[model samples]
Target: MSFLSFSPCCVKGGILPGVPRGDYDTSTLKKVGGYHVNSSDGMIGDGKVALVIFADIFGLQVPNCQILADGFSDELKCHVFVPDYIPNPPPNSAFTQVAKTFPEEYANRPWYISLIEWIKTIFKAWKWIPTFLFQGNQIRLAQAAVDNLITEGYTTIMSIGYCRGATILEYLLSSSSNVIQCAVLCHPEPKPRLYNHINRPTIWNIPDHDTFFKSNEVDILKRIMGKKVKDQGLEFECFVHKDTVHGFANRPTLDHEATKIAFEKVNNDAIEFFKRHLLQ
Candidate 1:
């Protein structure tokens, strides 16, 4: 996890692979507990274990995030929630339009076209960029949402986050305030005091070459987490996928075979993770 850097190129992401498939159906989406929930008829889990998906900058509106929420809900047999923590979308604009639908919009686009459009997107989305970058309010909302879930009687809760959501997940993981038991982070740009606070098991799905988290920093994070597992007996694992870039797991371009593999790998790994942790 290239220390989940806040580099200039964080805005310039790579191919987000996979078309929505499996149980990633959107028809299951509904409103529950002040969030967009993926469930059938508003029921969440067996009132036992549940999962929370902290979404990327694309927020809960994008198919990318919805797919994850829905798929995880079905596979894990646990209801999932995507909090509407990012409030008040900006005035309609080209960037907002693309952010809302980049999964389908860029599905077949060539890398060059995607690059150009995204570069343009950065400039066009000036109004929204700051919102994604400064997630102070969102962080509070997400934390409170989890607290509310616990108050509502969910016995076990786990979370997985992508990019911006990863930043917030780290905040949750490090806190002593919640009973959150596990985490899955995809290409997260982790915050400072990196290993100081995480109180539970965490899994990382990161790319080998990504401007977002950097290769050098990945080595450092992996090393520290490995030591924590040994010295503190807390579980931790990381997968540095070869020949991929940042955002590959969450929003892969799918134009390349490696990216497609990366996407599937992430999904499979997360399922196994939750099954092992939550089912036991």
Candidate 2:
């Protein structure tokens, strides 16, 4: 991925710096009165909010990711940026060749590490940096994407991730210059503990799905929330959705009736939170 040069206010030395205080012009929203789409694919709403989406380990090109993006885009009057960080390998991919290099423990971990290991093994097999650099390069690519969008005048940012993508988003929120004004994380894995430190309007939905979710991660989450989180001297609004697994937002895997109810909770709560807390 190509490196980005930050503006003066958002730079310290040569590195991209933290967010600078600047009022956003939220008036120039695209009207959606006559919105039309040949298919229900990627239909964005006419709300005056910009959205940033972090796809699951597979990336945003997938059907499920596009549908979620379309829903948010239409309701938020926003543009969704889905970065293709993972390069898709050919079909009937040689898993054994890649698996030989890494231990069995790494294999059992989340998809991100598995992808990283696969790239490393692929590099060992192919002797090319492209394969090995895919993981790191994709992250930097997402960062560059944030820089580009910030300059293009996006005020509010919301990140939706599942599994390994959730953990990566936590890292991005910590280091990126575009401090998301509003954010949502669905069925996050490695349970985002440090998110309590983030003062921005944020939501964390953890589903009771994989071993990672069932493991001691719940204890970790409790500990994170146990600490005092004071923004404007008020406690943040956080909701925990029990009995739901990870990737609850994906329509294909989701229990339609339950998902509809759950999403109503998320969408209504998030929109209200952003309006009350952020737009104040």
Candidate 3:
């Protein structure tokens, strides 16, 4: 069972409000009705629409996701659920280290199995669990959350994710028939190898900072787009922020002047895209 069982009463009680405000390693993921699994809640208008903002590997500690959540809640007038899967005070170990620490015998274990083991070590050493195990589980939990929200009277559903979170959301979008009106990704991981399974009105933001956004990166995106990126099907916008790095826009620590300019333009575009695709 999910640690955070999607419950309408939880949303009504306003228990899940905005992302957790603390360091990931030191924070316990707030659970809606079970163990630790923190979440935030807000909406655009009067709570007619809903959005779920999933975060990258660093978990909700990335301030950009928080900024986006605030802006999205305002623009969409829908409750936003930003859940933290990474336990607090993240284990002092890096993902690569955690991945390597598995018993030599478990080296070939399934990715999910290895991830659970990692979470166990992390939770035992500290009060937190590594989000590595939540990789494939976030969307399923998110979908359940949406279903719960729908019972609370939300009609529209939208999802947005950055980096690895976006990659997972893509999988969720492709697999589920949930009423996800539209899905957007910013700096998401490209589909491994050639992905020929895209089927949604998607939009991507590519800034100049990410290494992959360089000339070669554009080629890769183009290759990925291969025929899927069209005016009507999917809109791929590469608005390079003259000079900026990854995690620029919503990341306060890295928010450069260029990031500000880029985000101003992209944020507006995102609102319009969601409005057109999700509400209209």
Best by TM-score: 1
lDDT for each residue of candidate 3 in 1-280, tens digit (9 for 90 to 100): 2212233233311123245342222222333221121224443445567676766666654444654665566566555666563334243233433432111324566989777877867555543343544455665565555566577687877777766566666676666365666777766655545244555666667666564446576566666665666534665444555554444434322223454455466667677777876554
Look at candidate 2 and tell me the lDDT of residue 161.
54
| Each model's backbone clash number | 10, 7, 28
Q: Cα miss at 83, model 3 (Å)?
A: 2.6
Tell me the deviation in Å of residue 217 in model 1.
Answer: 1.2
**C-alpha lDDT of residue 232 in model 3:** 41
Q: In candidate 1, what are the lDDT values of residues 27-46, reduced to their tens digit?
A: 21232233444444344346
Runs of candidate 2 exceeding 4 Å displacement: 1-48, 89-135, 176-178, 191-197, 230-238, 251-260, 275-280
All candidates' lDDT scores? Answer: 0.68, 0.47, 0.54
Total clashing pairs in model 1: 10
lDDT of 3 at 218: 59
Weakest ten-residue segment in model 1 by summed lDDT: 1-10
Judge candidate 2 against the unseen true structure and give its global Cα lDDT, from 0 to 1: 0.47
Candidate 3: lDDT of 19? 54
Error of 3 at 74 (Å): 2.1
Task: Name the top lDDT candidate.
Answer: 1
TM-score of each: 0.75, 0.58, 0.60
